[model samples]
Target: MAAHNHIPLPIGQVPSSPYYIHPSDMNSMQFVSNKFKDEGFTDWKRSMTISLSTKNKLGFVTGIINKPNLQYASYKQWERCNDMIISWIMYNLDAMIARSVLYFNIAAEIWKDLEDRYDSIDAFFTKMKMLWDELHLQSYSKDFQTTTRSEANAVLDEAQ
Candidate 1:
């Protein structure tokens, strides 16, 4: 009989603490403007997700609300998180955009509406092709080599 050596799988590293996004930071955060659909949508989405996660309110953005049968304490916590997420989103949005989503009571509903509006597969591919063309056009310009390294990297990161 041969003896086998057992190896343990590595555990995932835990975050030291929940992320915190200051209210002041939220106030100053760039609004998702009209150009967001064509140019900045992915970056805006990534930043918003990170901000929500850091505030420990990502559950409200991503998760469903508790059932009516849930305990009072659970329901209260959900409500608080939902309110915080809604406030944070409203604070960071353009006035026009804010008006559109202001009536959403569920954080997940707001999140889904934004995703459905901006993150459809066709939109993603169109954005990618536009970015590729822009990069190609810039490649022929004099400063492209020096100027676009960071911008190109950001575009690539968002595409993935």
Candidate 2:
């Protein structure tokens, strides 16, 4: 098996071919097993195609990471991106687990509330995504006062 394209998935009892496995789970398993230390990274990139159901497109906003040049990157470089995704997930997962243990009562903990109230991780992610996109553009537009003004305007407009 090609090292970069066929990292084993951590799904169930049976090990199937590369197609049926989830690239994300394969990435998590790569963390514990040194066998995945150098495993090819093709399995880690699960977002090349639209997920149809989630409708969430995956893109890296911060620094230069993998740019989806699937035809160009080497297995080693793929490994680096895999590491990056693992780190990002770890940070988010840490927040998620901490929020669960904290009983979901904190007002400053939106992610925790999302995780606790949502049915699945994907559902929580979709909600978080909406919050992130709407945040700076609308939620915090002018200041705290903008929220009240906007809401009052909307309500008044609705009544008219």
Candidate 3:
């Protein structure tokens, strides 16, 4: 018989392939717990980003690496990686938030949804700080006119 080139098959397609074994679960302790708090969000984002990047799973969450084409040999491997990433994210999330995101089919959508929900917190705090600084800088006097102006400012600030 003539010698034939042996092309490797994609993972999970071949019953004997070692790639059929599942990957180890990601450690969740390093990431900030998503306690559904606005303050905890920044830490959670930073920690999760670092952890995912370290594991080379950042692309899955960022949508930079898409699922492989059906004809590709790596499709099964990609799916496994995607599922692992999704599980990592879910494992670190607060129960309520996890439930909300449980139905997401892709890691990118879950990442985007969480970002949209929590990323605005910084902006909100910044705006509030600016308003407070402006209020503090205003000169107030004992005179009726100045006192009235300060009162009006206080009302406006509270309304914000």
- Say which candidate scores most in TM-score: 3
* Whole-model lDDT, model 1: 0.63
Q: Candidate 3 — which pairs collide?
A: none
Query: How far in Å is the alpha carbon of 8 misplaced in model 3?
Result: 7.8
Clashing pairs in 1: 19-54
Cα lDDT of model 1 by residue, 90-136, tens digit: 76666777678899988788878877776775577777888899888
- Estimate candidate 2's alpha-carbon lDDT, on a 0 to 1 scale: 0.35
For all predicted structures, in order, the TM-scores are: 0.54, 0.20, 0.65
- Tens digits of per-residue lDDT for model 2 on 66-104? 333557524334444344443433333335443343442
The reply for model 3, stretches above 4 Å from the true place, is: 1-24, 27-30, 33-38, 133-160
lDDT leader:
3
lDDT of 3 by residue, 1-160 (tens): 9999999766655544422433454534435445444465767888889877766668788888787797987777777777777777887877778899999988889999999988887657766777667656654534433657668667567745
Local accuracy by lDDT, each model: 0.63, 0.35, 0.71
TM-score of 1: 0.54
Cα miss at 56, model 1 (Å)?
1.7
The C-alpha stretches of model 2 lying farther than 4 A from their native spots are 1-73, 95-160
